[model samples]
Target: MLDVAINHAVVIDTEKSVEKKINIGIKDGKVVLLTTDTLIATRVIEAKNLIASPGFIDVHGHVDGYAYSGELSACQGITTTVGGNCGLSPVDIADFFARQMRDGFVINQAELIGHSFSLRQAVGIADPYRQASPEEFAAMEQLTRTALQAGACGVSFGLDYSPGASFVEITALANVCAEFNRVMPIHTRLFTQNDLYSLFEVLAVAKRTGVRLLISHFVYQYGTGIMEEALQIIDQAIENGIDVKIDSGMYTDWTTFIGTATFDEQTIADNEMRFSDMVVASGKYLGKRLDRELYLKMRKHYPNESVICFMGNKAEIYTALKKSYAMPSTDIGTYKKGEGHPQIAGSFPKYFKEMVKERGDLSLIEAVTKATLLPAKTFGFAHKGVIKVGSDADITLFDFEHLKDNADFPDRGKPDAKPTGIEYVLVNGTLAVDQGGFTGEKAGRIIRV
Candidate 1:
C-alpha cells in the first residue's frame, strides 16, 4: 500500500514537453509508481482538471531558516529553495542544518556559504571599502573550506555589497569552490550606472578558476537595457566551454539593505540613481519614497531595512528569462505579513501567468522546466525536480487560466496577497497548502549537498 495516491492528474513532465493524465503512487516520501494500475493507498487525492508539475525550486533566496518566509515560499509552490544568497547567511552551515532538522522546516533548503557579509564578519574583516589583508584572506579560506566540508552547496558573493573584495580574495574563494566541485553564485559588483565590467569581473573569476558559475539575479544585474549584450557574453563563455548560467526573478526592481556599500552616497551618485527612485520597503518608513533627509535618517536608524531601487528595464526581464540557460528565481527573504517585495509571494505565479499564459513567449512545458528541472540539475539534486516514478513526491497543482499574481508594490497595494489559482501544494508526500490554504504542517527538510 502506498502512503498517498494522486489519481488521474494532468502531470507535466518537465524532462519532456508533454502532459498526460497519470496516477502517482507515493510511499516513504518517494514516488512509487505512475500508471493506470489499481493502486491502493492510505490516502488518495482526486486531482481532476489540475496540472500537476514538480514543485518549483527557487534558485536564489534568503529564507535562511526564517519561519514566516519559509511559509511564504511553500505557499508559492516552492518545495525547494537555495538560500544564503547575496553575501548573507548563517556562519555555521552544519549547525544551521542540524537545527533545521531538529525543529523541522516547511520546505527543503540548500544553503551556500556566503561571502562579503557573513564570512567577512566572521573573519573580522570590518572595512567594506578596503581589501582584506593576506592573513584575513587566509583565515577566510579556512572558514570557507570548513563550511564546504560541512555540506554547503556553494559559495555566494555579493561583490557590489563588498566593493573592497580584491581579485585575490575572490580567486581564492573560487579556487576552494572549484576544488570541492561546488557552484559559485555571484552577485557581481556594480560601481557605476550600466556597468558591465562588474559582470566581467565574475566572468574573469570563472575564466581563471574554472568554477561552475551561477550568476545571481540576472535582471537585477543587467536589466538596465543591456540584457541582450549580457546574454551574448554568457553565450560566448559557454561556447568557449565555460559553465555559466543565470537566474532572474519576474520583477525589474530589486531590494537590499540601505546601509550596504551599494547604498552609499557615492554609489548612488555613480550609478546615477535618484532618491526619488528608491522606496522604503521595510520598517517604519515602509511605503515612503526616499529623499536626502529621509535617506540620511533611514541610513542611520534603519541600517538593516530593505529598500527597493527602481533601476531596471521591464523588457530586459523577459529578455533574460527567454534564454535557454536562465532559470526563474524569487530572491525571497524574511518579511512580516504585510511587509516585503511582491516577488516573495508572486514570482513563480507571475512567471507562468506573464511568460506563458499572457505573452506566449514560453510554452507551459518550457516554463515549468525552467522553474523545476533546470534548477534541480544545476544543484545536482537527483530526485526533486521531475514528476516521474521514483522521484520525490513534491508537487504543485494549479489552474493555468486563473493563475495570476495579485501582489503588487507597497504603494500599489498589499505585497503579501496570496495568489489566485494555486490549488494545492505538497512537500514530501504531505500537504503543506491545500486548496489555496495553508495546512499548518511543516514537512520540509534540510538538503545537504
Candidate 2:
C-alpha cells in the first residue's frame, strides 16, 4: 500500500515538457508510481482542480535553521531553501547540517560556505575593509575545503559587505569552488546605484575561474534605471560561454542588517538614497521609515536589526525575471513572527500570481519550470525538483485561479500573514501543509553536493 496518494491532479513534469492529469503514489519518501489507474493509500489528497508542481525551490535565502523562517517557506510552497547566502553563514557547515538533521526541520535545506564574512571572520580577519593576508587567505581556502567536504553545496559572496576583498582572493576561493564543481552565488560589490562594473567583475570571475555563477537579487542590485543594460551584459556573458544565472524577488526594496557596510553613511550617499526611502523591517522600530536619528540609533544600538532599503524600479522586477535565465527567490532573513519583509511569506505565491495569473508574462508551465527545475539543476539537486516515478515526492498543489499573496510590508499589513490557495504541500512524501494549513510535519532532509 502507498504511504500517501494524490488523486486527479494535473501534474507538471518539468523535465519532460508535459502537464497531464495523473494519480501519484508515494511510498517510503519517494514517488513510487504515476498512473491514471486507482491506487490505495493510507492517506489521500483529493486534488481534482489543483495543479501539482514540484515544490518550489528558493535559490537565495537566509533562513539557515530558523524554525519560523522554515515554516514560512513551507507555507509558501517552498519545500527546499538554499541558505548561507550574502556572505553570512554558520562557520561550521558540518555542525550546521548535523544540528538540523538531529533536530528536524520543516523544509529541506542546502547551504553555501560564505565568503566576505563567515570565512573571513573564521580566518581571523575581522576588519571588512582590510585585505586578507596571504596566510589568512590560505587558512580560508582550507576552511572552504573542509566545509565542502562536510557537504556544503557551494560558496557565496557578499562583496558589497567587504570592500577590501581583492580580486585575487575572490578568484582563489572561486577556483576552489570550481574544483569541487560547486556553484558560486554572489551579491556583487556595488556601492553606487548604476555600477555595472560590479556586475562585470562577477562575470569576469566566472569567465576566468570557470565557476557556475548565480547572481543573487539581480533586480535589487541593478533595477535602478540600469536593468536593461545589466541583462544585456549577462546575456553577452552567457553567449560567450560563461556559465551564469540570476535569482530575483518581486519587490524593489531589499533588506539587510543595519550594521553592514551597505547602510554606511558614505555608501548610502553614493547610492543617492534618502533616509525616508528606508524602513525598519525588524527590531523596536519595525514599520517606521528611517530618519537620521532612528537610522543612527539602530545602526549603533541595534546593529543586528534588519532594515529595508527601497531603491529599485518596480517594473524592472518583471523585466529581470522575464529572462529565461532568471528565477524568483525570497532573499528571506531570519525574522520573528509579524516582523519581516512580506517576501518571507509571499514570494513564491506572488511570483505565480503576478507572473502567471495576473500579468500573463509567464505561462504556468514556464513559471513552474523556473521555480523548480531551474534551481534544482543549478544547485545539483538531482532528485528534489521533478515529478517522475523515481523522483523524491516533494510536491506543491495549488489552485491557480484563487492564488493571491495577502502579506505586505509591515507598514501596510501583516508581514507574516499567509497566502491563500496553496491546497497541499508535500516534502519528502509527508504532508507538510494540508488543506491550506501547515501540518507541522518535519519531513525535509539536508541536501549536500
Candidate 3:
C-alpha cells in the first residue's frame, strides 16, 4: 500500500498548462503514481474541492530555523524555504544544518552564505563605511569556500546595508561562487529613490563574472514606477547570455531593522524617505508610526526591532511580477504572532488572490509554475518543486475559490494568522498541516547544495 494518497483532486500540472482531476500516491517521500482511478493507501485524503499542486518554495526568506517563523511559513503552504538571505546568516552553516537535523524543523531549509553582515562580522570588520582590506578579502574567500563545501546553496550580498563594500570584495566572492557552480543572490544597493543604477550594478556582475544572479525583491528595488524599464534591462542581459533572474514579494512595501545603515539619517535623507512613512512593527513601539523622538529611541534602544517602510508603488509590484522570470517570495523572519509585516504570512495567498483569482494577470497553472518549477530550476534543487513520478512528495491542497490571506500589517491584526482554504500540506509525504490546522509534525529536512 502507498504511504499516503490524495484522491479526487484537481492536480495542477505546472510543466504543462493543464489541471486534471486525479489521484496521487506517495511512498518513501516520493510520488508513486498519478491516475484517475481509486488508489489504496495507509492514509488517504478525500480532496473533493481542492486543487493539488507541488509544494511552494519560498526563494527569499530570512527564517533561519526560528520555530515561530517556520510555523508561519508552513501555514502558508511553503514546504521548502531558502533562508539566510539579505546579508545575514549563521556563520557556521554545517552546525546550523546539524542543529536542524537534530532538533527537527517544520519546513525544509536551504541557506546562502551571507556577505555584508555575516562574513564581515566573522572577520571583525565592524565598519560598514570602509572597504575590506586585501587580507580581509582573502579571509572572507576562505570562509565562503568552506561554507560552499558544507552545502551552502549560494552567496548573498546586501550591498545597501554595507555601502563600504567595494567592487573588489563583491567580485572576489562571486568568483568563489562561480568556481563552486553556485548562484549569487544580491540585495542591490539603493542609492536613492528610483535607483535603476543599483539594478544595473548587479547585472554588470553577471556580465563580468558569468555568475548566475538572482536579484532579491525586484519590486522593492525598482517599484518606484521603473519596473518595466528594469525588466527590459534584465531581458537585454538575458539576451547577452548572462543568467539573471529575480524574486519579488507580493506587496510594494518592504521591512527591515530600525538600526541598520539603511535607516541612518544620511541614508534616509539621500533616499528622500520621511520618518513619518515608517511604522514600528515590533518591540515597545509596535503599531506606531515613527516620529523623530520614537525613531531615536528605537534606533538607540531596540536596534534589532523591525520597521515597515510605506514606500514603493502598488502598480509596480504587479508589473514586476508580470514577468515570467519572476518568482514569488516572502521576506519572512522570526516575530511574535501579532507583530510583523503581513507579507510574512500572506504573500503566496495574496499572489494567487490577486494574480489568478481576482485580476486574472496570470492563469492558475502559470502562477503555480512561477511559485514552484521556476525557483527550483533557478536554484538547482533537483528533487523538489515538480509534481512528477519519483519527485519528492511535498504537496499543498487548497480551495481556489475560498482562499484568502487573513494576515495584515501590525496595525490591523496578527501578521502570523494562518490563511484560509489551505486544506492540507504534506512535507516528505507526512501530514504537517491537516484540514487547515498544524498537525504538530516536523517532517522537514535540510536541503544541501
Best by lDDT: 2
lDDT of 2 at 108: 94
Model 2 alpha-carbon miss at residue 167, Å: 0.5
Tens-digit per-residue lDDT, 207-234, candidate 2: 8999999999999899999999999999
Model 3 off-target regions past 4 Å? none
The Cα local distance difference test for each model comes to 0.90, 0.93, 0.90
TM-scores, all models, native as reference: 0.98, 0.99, 0.98
lDDT ranking of the models: 2, 3, 1
Candidate 3 residue 353 Cα shift, in angstroms, is 0.6
Q: Give the better candidate number (1 or 2) by lDDT.
A: 2
List candidate 2 segments past 4 Å from native. none
lDDT of 1 at 408: 83
lDDT of 3 by residue, 1-449 (tens): 89999999999987776899989999998998998898889999999999998999999999899988888888889999999898899888999999999999888999999998999999999989889999999999999999999999999999989999988789999999988989899999988877889888888777778888999988888888788888999999888898988999988888999999999999899988988888888887888999999989999999999999998889888788878888999999788778899988999998999989999999999999899989998888987888879899999999999999998878768777778988899999998889999887899999899
| True-vs-predicted CA distance for residue 195, candidate 1, Å | 0.7
